[model samples]
Target: MVIFGCVGIIAGCGSLGLWLANRIRRRPVELREFLMALSLLDTEIVWGATPLPEAFGILKERTDAPWQGFFADLQDRLQRGESASIAWNDVSLAQNSHFCLKHEDWQVIRDVSKGLGRSDRQEQHKQLELIQRQLALIKDQAGIWSEKQAKMWSYLGFLCGIAGVLILI
Candidate 1:
């Protein structure tokens, strides 16, 4: 029973590490998909010549989960006559416990929201393009962190677990 308990502890620790690493990996993918959705919105604005509220209403293809909820909330807020910035702020996906976004990610979204639909078409395009560039850079950084740190976190957890078991024994 003692040996089995120790083995369970080790396995649990290792699995916990892997789970955390998965969370780390997930952030970038989510952010990238979010960016793609934003780009689609940008296309609607620039090419389709749609207004902000209508553009949001027209977007049916959400690439991920919370984003659909986020946008739905946003549209609802807009329908209530709240400004774009307020609506975006109100529909914060970052506040979700299951979401893997960092403060930086939240900052990016917040910054993007602040000017959304407030500027002229040309200026909006420029602003969104800049946001896209920033998001791409952050996504790259997250990819690197996932690649390098995830293994480290898993290995370190396993080693730490083993060390703890040995010490206990």
Candidate 2:
């Protein structure tokens, strides 16, 4: 009877842990999809020689719903006397790399800004493509990480449940 009780407790905990992991794992993928879509638009704007501030602002305005929070945060950081690099660092911390900007992304931003002045649209486009590709790669890696973490959590939860049962026994 004690053994049975232990197994029941373990099973319950394992189920709960798996549920939580599944919930946590789903959002980042959606975020990545949204970011990938945004990257396409951003690439166009950058390559067209649009000013970085204007491009960012426009993108922020166009973004919708849950996704907007990140861009809004980025805009706020950028507006409050933060350099692009610093702003990106904050962004990297706040968001998963799939959706959040990074140092390299900022470098592209800086290059686009400079390229615009130099009328080097080609370079700006090239940089935009590079950034988009980087983001795509990050998104792919993030997907793998999320899946792996979810699996790990499930396995650990199972182990924990087994331990709990053994304790009761």
lDDT of each: 0.81, 0.61
Each prediction's RMSD over C-alphas, in Å, is 1.8, 5.6
Q: For candidate 2, lDDT tens digit of each residue in 55-108?
A: 556666777644456567666877786765566556645664443333543443
Least accurate stretch of 10 residues (summed lDDT) in model 1? 57-66
Q: What is the lDDT of residue 61 in candidate 1?
A: 46
CA lDDT for candidate 2: 0.61
**Could you say which candidate leads in lDDT?**
1
lDDT of 1 by residue, 1-169 (tens): 9989899889988988888888887888888987998898889888989877777775544556767666766777888899998778767853455578898888887777867879877788888889999999999999888878878888877887888899899
Off by over 4 Å in 2: 1-12, 27-31, 34-38, 47-50, 61-67, 94-122, 141-145
* Superposed model 1: Cα runs more than 4 Å off: 58-60, 93-96
